[model samples]
Target: MGETRREMKQSESLQASLPEDIALKIASFLPVGDLCALGSCSRFWREFCGSDVLWESLTRQRWPSLNFSTESSSVDHGDSSSLEGWRDLYVKWHAKMPEAMLVVQHVNQCAVSGSLDIRDFLKAIKHLNSMGLGFKDVEMFLLRPEVNVLLNLVGLHYCVHCLKVPAEHVMEALRNSKISQREVCVKWWNLGRLLFNGFGMRDESHCRLVSLQDLALPQDNQVLAVIHRGQFTRSFASRYPYSILLVLPGLSRSSQVCD
Candidate 1:
């Protein structure tokens, strides 16, 4: 215990001799972990290492893509005037990245399979939620081009029309997304139009019915028989683009349109 105390005192004396400006300058070059460790020495060291300049440098080094000034403004990131802002942002981003990559990899695998499997996708969502990433993290993950491309391919564009997928798969995705029901309903409608109009599909009954159900409002199941064979005329289809929207009263006019 005596020797340890002597060593600690010697270390503290050496660090104390360095000018504060020089100490902060040197800290800027240290890795985040080293800076964190150095902060444990004393209150002065903790305050010195917790400067915004040092944490900003560390944050940029760790995540080069983050434009802290602009992106931080859009989110409710507390205390941008201090090091807490950069430190907290980096911690959240770093913690979420691994799980986000895992989600991308799973979606890519599904894309490769050329089918939308509800069980597999639901399993991915469950794993993502288990990782403690909240709705904001999931939203950011979807914005990533690498993840978004794979998701669009397997989730909407190709897989929606693939014979290997069924209405149940789309319904399951809608149920598990954790986003707004209206967003999920719009996604299904967009996929159905892409599959039917752009790709020359003769049937959209299953996709449309699943989309209507995604509205989450009670609807007449008897309507299923009305469109079971997708026999609605072009005029009716154009006039009533989405029967689901009729039941939703508070949404804006623009939100109701699939376009």
Candidate 2:
């Protein structure tokens, strides 16, 4: 009984000495496990540590590309009947992070082995989709420096080198990639000599979805001329007549040059 009273008095003194904002700032620096433990100390600390604002900041810091505004707003407006608080959301996402990381690891392993499994790559895409991510969100996530490198390497191997993965699968992944397209194209362009040396254009569909503009600098006209004269074929030229005319010096839309 005496010890309980003493502990209560100590907690009360600490609460009185520390302003709520200062306490929250200090608490924000705590690891998730430490923060949860602190919340168990008392009702005041529990509510303080579980503030949606605090948890929302933490969640965003951990997953910058993810949007939790809807969930956070619902919790803030006392709509707990439908949506969970940011703390709960953070815990849920944190718990599932390992699964997401495992998918990334699987992709990394495939890239390292120089044999990308379209199934594993598709699994990663499916996982992102299951998380309620749209194409733009997926593109942003894939653009993270670490992820971008792995994605490009795997793409080059599967799409150009091995040529094992199907064109549809490649297109599916590309649809979710925007900035990463340039690196993949540059890689493919560099390996053009290899393709010309022997491989030839066995499957034109493999690169049909690739953006020609991404293959070189916007001002570099050589890429368009090379595509026009290289293995891209007349159909390829006709399909990108606008892009060709924009880059190629002598070509005009009225010239019927692409035709």
RMSD in order of candidates: 17.0, 14.5
Q: For each of the candidates, give the backbone clash count.
A: 0, 0
Residue-pair clashes, model 2: 0
The superposed Cα distance between candidate 1 and the true structure at residue 90, in angstroms, equals: 2.0
List model 1 lDDT by residue over 1-259, tens digit each: 9999999888878878889899898888787779899888777698788776676667665454345677555433364454345566667667766666676787566535333344444455555545544323433564223343324322332222222234455445445554323322221222234454467544443233133333322243333332222333121134433222111324343533334
Tens digits of per-residue lDDT for model 2, 1-259:
9999999999877786788899899898887789999989887788799887788877876565567777666664455475567888877776664454555676666545333333454455555545643222333344334464445433323232222333344445554454334332211122233464676554322222233223222344343334333333222233321121111233333324323
Pairs that collide, model 2: none
Task: Give TM-scores for every candidate, taking all chains together and pairing residue i with residue i.
Answer: 0.36, 0.44
Over 4 Å off, model 2: 1-4, 101-259
CA displacement after TM-score superposition, residue 7 of candidate 2 (Å) = 4.3
